[model samples]
Target: MLNLTLSTSSYFILGSYVHIGSLKYLYFMLTAMLYIVIFIVNISLIVVICMNRSLHEPMYLFLCSLFVNELYGSTGLFPFLLVQILSDIHTVSAPLCFLQIFCVYTYVNIEICNLAVMSYDRYLAIYCPLQYNTLMTFNKAVIFIAVIWFYSFVKFLITLSLNIRLTFCGNVINSVICHNYLVVKLACSDTRVNNIYGLFGTVLSILVPLLPIIFSYMEIFKVCFSGCKQTRQKAVSTCTPHLASLLNFSFGCCFEIIQSRFDMTSVPRLLRIILSLYFAIIQPLLNPIMFGLQMSKIRNTCKRVFCYKMLTRHKDTM
Candidate 1:
């Protein structure tokens, strides 16, 4: 039996990396390009929302929070990925690994909470249009955003504290990134506390956001079915991108959870790697593109901003 206990100076070996030899360069370039695109698109949308007074509504404010999170989550993963792809060894220090775990867990929590809040905002807009302004004021929206972020951080800070107390029997993590569950599994010390809290945390994470999301959508559907054609169209247009994003993120997260908790040695290694990366990479890229194209207000504002920049550049050249 492996009896080594993890210490502050210890490092973890990431065991999922396949040595692709010269192909590592190709992988590195693609990852770098993907990271760059995710950064630019998410940042552009955030800038647009912040600069436009017309977009100061609750929906846009929620969206700005979402985009900022995309940047936060992507930054946590992509830089580490880029370095690992180019390096000969696949290891990360204990502190860095735990930091990644904190970033990732908090990002997921904030994302689901943000989406749930957005759904409630949509519900107010559609169901109680008369009172929407008063019900979801700018101040209220700001407070919701603040609470979602703050709550997620505190919740995961406790989780990290629990995991930090564990003395690991092994220092090898079977995934490309530092995963909390996988790290806990390596503990030589008693992890009953960690496991119990983990189960409670998971339930809270899903239920807190999920219950509101379900209620909001149920109310929305009720209004849509009985209301005018305009009401149905409004719901369809606004909810489609959100629904798509939610489903996409959910699927990615589900696959990751399943992969982490179960034995999946039968699955192809390449496919496993891709699926593991889906949530972090695809969701961030997808949210900006989907929201940018589907929302007319954002689209038109982007066009105006682009045209103004071009016109100013042309005058400077002249």
Candidate 2:
């Protein structure tokens, strides 16, 4: 049904704005508030982790990296979404759309990798305590972080390269977010190559990281079950935050991917939009809250920082 044509340039209509009819300003304000909260929470967590020397262990470093990735991912979407809400037109330039796709998807890839690494860190701490310091040293953490970012870039580049070269039949994406499959759907040319490569990238970017996390948790559970009550409680405390994050992100990803891949005309437009924006809005906002509130070390450091600032202000006023 899509007509293929040669055009100098094209813009995409974000058809996901249908639910935001008369409440544009209200929507913008609320989303802006959400974005601000996300920024504050993630930044606060990162600062808390970074400033505490005792908390510079592998788990905390990975948490900091996770927080940073959340900021990166949410930043890719929130500002743009706010602007789009204010404007009557819901179109984006070709280049900007592609850029968003790159930023957002790369954020996701890095998130999966970061969480995987965090699980591995916990595993090393619990199961291989003697080697935790030696194996997961500061330099090794940096290397893992580097690999997370680098692999995300390389995988997304390959997929985007395939997408950019395609001739598009139309410029409308029926979703709130930009991703490779949506763009490929608009292509006038055969997309078998893109689809194949996209699948490969998905497996590499998501499943590869997930495999390690699952294995680490399994090993962790085995050790916990065989240990004393204190050991079991410690393991539960350490894994609870990571598992919560994994579930939140996993659900968001599954919703978005399913929406993109299947016919969702039967679903309500508003609900679909919410589901699509879940990763951008909810996961980023939730990660810091989960980790900061639940992880005792980060929580105590945050309280100390807050108390210190408050006392400093009170003394100055007195």
Best-fitting candidate, scored by TM-score: 1
lDDT of 2 by residue, 5-104 (tens): 2333477888777755778889888999999999999998888888889898877888889999999998899999888888888888877788899999
**Model 2, position 241: C-alpha lDDT score:** 85
Task: Assess candidate 1 and give its lDDT.
Answer: 0.93
Provide the overall lDDT of each model, using Cα atoms, as 2-decimal numbers: 0.93, 0.85
Q: Which stretches of candidate 1 lie over 4 Å from their true place?
A: 1-9
Give model 2's clash tally: 0
Residue 229 displacement (Å), model 2:
0.7
Tens-digit lDDT track of model 1 for 1-318: 322234533789999998899999999999999999999999999999999999999899999999999999999999999999998899998878988999999999999999999999999999999999999999999999999999999998888788777787788899999999999988888899999999999999999999999999999999999999999999999999999999999999998998888898999998998898789999999999999999999999999999999999999999
Q: Model 2 clash pairs?
A: none
Q: Clashes per prediction?
A: 0, 0
Give the TM-score of each candidate: 0.97, 0.94
lDDT at residue 15 of model 1 (Cα atoms): 96
Which run of 10 residues does model 1 get worst, by summed lDDT? Answer: 1-10
